[model samples]
Target chain A: MPKLPKPPKPPSYSEVRGTVQDNVIWKSIFRPGSIYRKGYRDTSRDRALAAMNNVLYHLHPVKVKRHGLKLTYTYCLGGLSFFMFILLTITGIFLMFFYTPAAGAGAEIAYLNMRELSTTVTFGALVRNLHRWGAHAMVFLVFLHMARVFYHGAYKPPREFNWVVGVILLLLTLFLSFTGYLLPWDQLALWAVTVGTNIAGFSPVFGDQVSFVLLGGLEIGPETLLRWYVLHVLFVPFITVVFLAVHFWRIRKDGGISGPL
Target chain B: MSDEVQMDQEVYDRLIGEGKSERIARAKAKAAAVRKSKIEEGATLGPKPAEEATKALEEFRSSRSGGGGVATKTAAPADGGGGGRLTPEERAARVSASLGNGGDSGSVGVPAASDHTHRLLALVPPAGIQQVQSKQQDKVYTWPHLLLVEFVALLAAGSLLLVASFFLDAPLGSLANVNEVPAINKAPWYFMGLQELLAYFHPAVAGITIVGAAVLLLMSLPYVDKNPSAKPENRKFANMAFTFFLAFWGILTIIGSFIRGAGYEWVWPWVQGLGFVL
Candidate 1:
């Protein structure tokens, strides 16, 4: 009988991993100093290079004051506020897929969309819950962050301008939340917004004009819904992001984190 | 300018006698002639004498002390106390002796007083140099240190939000009807404090003026409080005022959200059920 053919041997895990890591495509994906690269080690040079070569370099410096690492010092309020904003954006996008900004007269597409979103779509209710709660959390966090900065007196000297930027960001956050509140088109959303916008109508000289501009007519309607939807998803967020960039840039320019005191 | 330069015969002869090369001696003699002409045209040369510097320092110290200022003592020359003039060679010998080199054997190549022909390469102003006022601070790399903490914070917040989302469902009331108005209409919780203010003040005052003024004050806090200190002990009033504002707002918000019922009147949440929504 002829000798049985030997079964071919498979490549080892390490060999396959090595081949994948050494490929041109992988090398392009991870820059020269990336810790994800094949030869990375926990050396001082590699650690610095990891931060320097990454996209996060824009937000973080290569090194930070050691005291900033302490949880109580910052309570991580500002970072968490930013994280909540990101969370809300993601969840807001998911909701936008199922939502329609139409309302008024015979058509109530916006209200219909809200009902179907909570009932029919997969994970819709969960995402909506996260968006709502995260928005509230973000507003609360931003306020707490301001308070933290005040108590620490981190708003002194070179940081004073950044504090003003921060206040603007806080106002933007509130506007974002208020606009989103009206999107649900429920009694709670409509009347809450009516009460909120009525305050804008009280602005001394331009009261009537501002109210008309906000409502798109004399009161809440399909036009108002569309206008606010754009503000919530696009206009306000765009402005907030611009200010966020400046705020983070100033933090680095003004000598990193504040004091041990 | 080159044609006008004339070599000083006396300087050339002295340099030659001191064993300098012909090229160096000739260059030095020409430079000396140029310097002499410049001096004749009113150019100043060299620094003030050590005695003058010592006298100025003494006078400054005395004036500062007389004005109740802290007197700063600098290291004045050991032999400068006599206030007597010394030749360049004697001064060089004293400097060398102070440095533990001493006498002619280790004289450090002091040039003669008349050697004013030495080239002036450049004059750098004091302001041209950088002054480092801050000392070294304790720091750590951001990659594993700060980024790791941030990652953990992100995970914690994300997980908490996820758990909340899983357990709780967002509220959805009946469709909006312009014809129907609810008995207890209120703003979102964040604006509840302002809404609560509506009970006591006019809408314009409670809503627009007060809110606007609060925001303006918050934005201008840094400029307003001119205190330079970051320490809490130095800013008691600022802290107290802010804390009071927070407490006032907090109380109003709580009253508006939980303790108020139909017609915006007060009622305990335990009895009326929560009239608020997120």
Candidate 2:
């Protein structure tokens, strides 16, 4: 009564006469044939598969035109600008962790925090330098990208809307740089922003109001620092990221970097 | 017969042969056939309005009947009447019609003589031509090529920035004091061009009016220019205008960065200065 039929055995690799290797242990670390799952064929097909399967690669088409591939044609200025933006974002976040944006804290305290960050925080100096240099580079690169588009006569017809968006992006990039200029609370940052905001003061009917809104007062001080802080850290960055997404999407829609008409 | 009368006759004869009454045929022919000239004719020559043509045709027919003149016997071939050779008179009339009309309306397989008409037609292309252009145009995929170029560009820029960061610490002056102003207070480098403009022109003009106007104009360039050509060689005026703008910005930026010193005074780059130098 207690004797039951032997349970059916599960299939084993040995039954298939395949040599058993410890591929399972290695499989956890490396995916064997994950890319060539359907079986490797020609290079062209593999390249196509690589582009189709990968998220980043798929943003591009399967093959670029020969002229489009020319380094000088685009100089990849737009890409450099974007890459620098990403670098700035990363390093900027790191700087923020150590940054103190107290409105009441005198520029002395603000400057002290920067010094402390460089001396105390690990890799803090590198992060700060990267953010600063990358930001400057981005400004230059974006301008170069615009120049390239202009000279290539790429803004004609279908690309008109994208060009307008790009112009807006250019203005936004400037705003980003200007807002960040006030963060260090150093003399250069202070006077530069003061000069910039003063230019805003010259707007016809909005002059006084613009300056008042920007500086939070008649002059740069605690409130100005606070306002600039929020803009640099929150508002400007958020807007930039949104516009950046649109800009990249437009590049694809506008036929991927302009070449000969 | 006068050329005009002969053309009207040939066209009317062809149209009447298509089972139309003489009055109706004359009106239809006038609406459809273009009169050829040394230069290409404009598109305004189409058949007259139905009411006007009918009225005019009725007047002509009544006058002809009143005059008691007999209508000539014309050999108007039926549609697609292949191998029906034209009589000598018909052949001469057809040849003369073709020559007068530039062969566009009467002859099969002969292209229109006017390039301008083809160009005008190109403005509203046939749908099939659009697909043909896309197929024939040289194009490359964006996959490996675009992505790879982007990757290489990023790597190069990143490396250069990394190196520059190590050598050049981001500039930070003493703590800000609203009570005091820096000797060479200036806007960011990109805005240096406008700032330099402020030096020469009134702030309102330079800062607000000029800059604002320039930006608006730049934005409106594509619309206002209205030239369909993209090639620089074909657009000399546009190219020169843009180049002038670029040169102005470039020159101003340079002057602001290197030439201008404390209190916005001019100084050579090599001159000893107590402030920022490019």
Candidate 3:
């Protein structure tokens, strides 16, 4: 198929100037949010409409001023959380091809798949290893990301809802990782989960009963694997994705990004 | 005018370093040129290199990101894959690699060449950048308003998490026999932070305090960093206190994990420099 050339829109002078003004070179040194267009000169009856249109300017007050996306403080840690998520998704997809949600064959299949990838296929093992490692890494990053947020005080007032959402995300992430462990259907996975759930059993008063409901029996077997598979594959992802959407949206609602201090 | 230019040049030299601005200018020019030429070539050729290049970059990025191909986070090393502890040479290699191999002579050679307009920006004064970039190797950070080092540390943490995940993938071998036990068993990394806390605090405290603290802190981040101290000097106390906490906790955890084999005998508190961890 041949490519079609589209006509370029005629440029507006002010728009062009704005683009030039917004360049990184200019933004870096100039404290952001300052020297910005205060708004259209026309106020009158259109003031409310104008303010509503100015998402960047009005949703959060201009008074909650801060620097742009400085890397060290919040953005970096946030970015780190994002990066780890990407890594997990990549490795996880590849693993799914080899993994089966059966307590009996799941672990055996995982081993076989990995072995085949190593012996027959060249880079397949690397991919699996990378995914496995990435999953573990996400948990650590999430916590550190939390630590950064705490020390920085980014969870106060207007951003409190998002902060709660973030905590849920962290729990969901741990749950996701835990569920994945059971899918391997190995002795270690079974027992670790058994011990892990048993610890859950220690929570409050009715812990053992709670774990039993989850496992669907007295032990970590096929039912447990199935439950874990469902949790990892369906439940956790759904919640995390929804929470993330809300979390990011809240940042916009509260303000673009917080200041560094 | 000449004196002002000299001052500006001096500032630039300080912020990005003497050769860096020139390097950036050259790099930008080279890139524009390369891109313009490629579009021109793509217009004449069968397939556009722009799309192909993007696809290729994405592929490379995904591979580098980790084994996961689930998309959405291929570039975030900490989130998608563990990239902690990049050596200096490794970092240099990464920087040069990111710049990509410069093209041969001509507009098509570098991406910056085809650009028609360039302007001097007073927003980020060259002098300040020069002052900051010059201190690249200095332990005492003199950040010129950009939080590069902090982000680097954050990225390190993120990457490590993913890497830790990879290492501990399917930690339990193939058997759902709740009765079995693996010899060198360990919890997943995130839980390890909690699990490790078990050794330090009583179960009640570990369960309620450390775990609770982490959860509470994460929930409170948006408010925590909402202060107007985007600038480091404005952030000295927060930064130092955080650094101290991180140092104490991080070092203690590392020792706890590695020295686990030594059987909890050598534990030491970093605060007292001796007994706290014990």
Q: Which one is best on TM-score?
A: 1
Report the C-alpha lDDT of model 2 over B1-278, residue by residue, as the tens digit. 23253245677888777788877876656544445431255544556666665465345444444443544233545334222344465455445444554322544333445443322232345765555235454655454466667787788878888898888777777878778877788877888898899888878888899989988887777678777787878878888888899899999988887788888899886784534621
The CA-based lDDT of model 2 is what? 0.73
After superposing candidate 3 on the true structure, give the runs of residues whose Cα lies further than 4 Å from its correct spot.
A1-66, A105-111, A117-122, B1-179, B196-256, B262-278
Which rank order by DockQ, best down to worst? 1, 2, 3
Interface RMSD of each: 0.7, 1.8, 9.5
Task: Give the candidate number with the greatest lDDT.
Answer: 1
lDDT of 2 at A228: 89
Candidate 1 residue lDDT tens string, A1-261: 999999888999988888989989999999977987889989999999999999999999999999999999998999999999999989999999999999987899999999998899999899999999999999999999999999999999989999999999999999999999999999999999999888899899999999998889999888999999999999999999999999999999999999977
Lowest summed-lDDT stretch of 10 residues in model 1 chain B?
B106-115
Q: What TM-score does chain A reach in every model? A: 0.95, 0.82, 0.68
Assess candidate 1 and give its lDDT. Answer: 0.88
Worst 10-residue lDDT window for candidate 3 chain A reads A56-65
Docking class of 1: medium
For candidate 3, the TM-score is 0.49
lDDT tens per residue, model 3, B206-248: 7555666755764555556556544556667776866776675
Candidate 1 segments whose C-alpha is farther than 4 A from its true place: A1-13, B1-131
Provide the TM-score of chain B versus the true chain B for each model in turn: 0.55, 0.51, 0.31
lDDT scores for all predictions?
A: 0.88, 0.73, 0.56
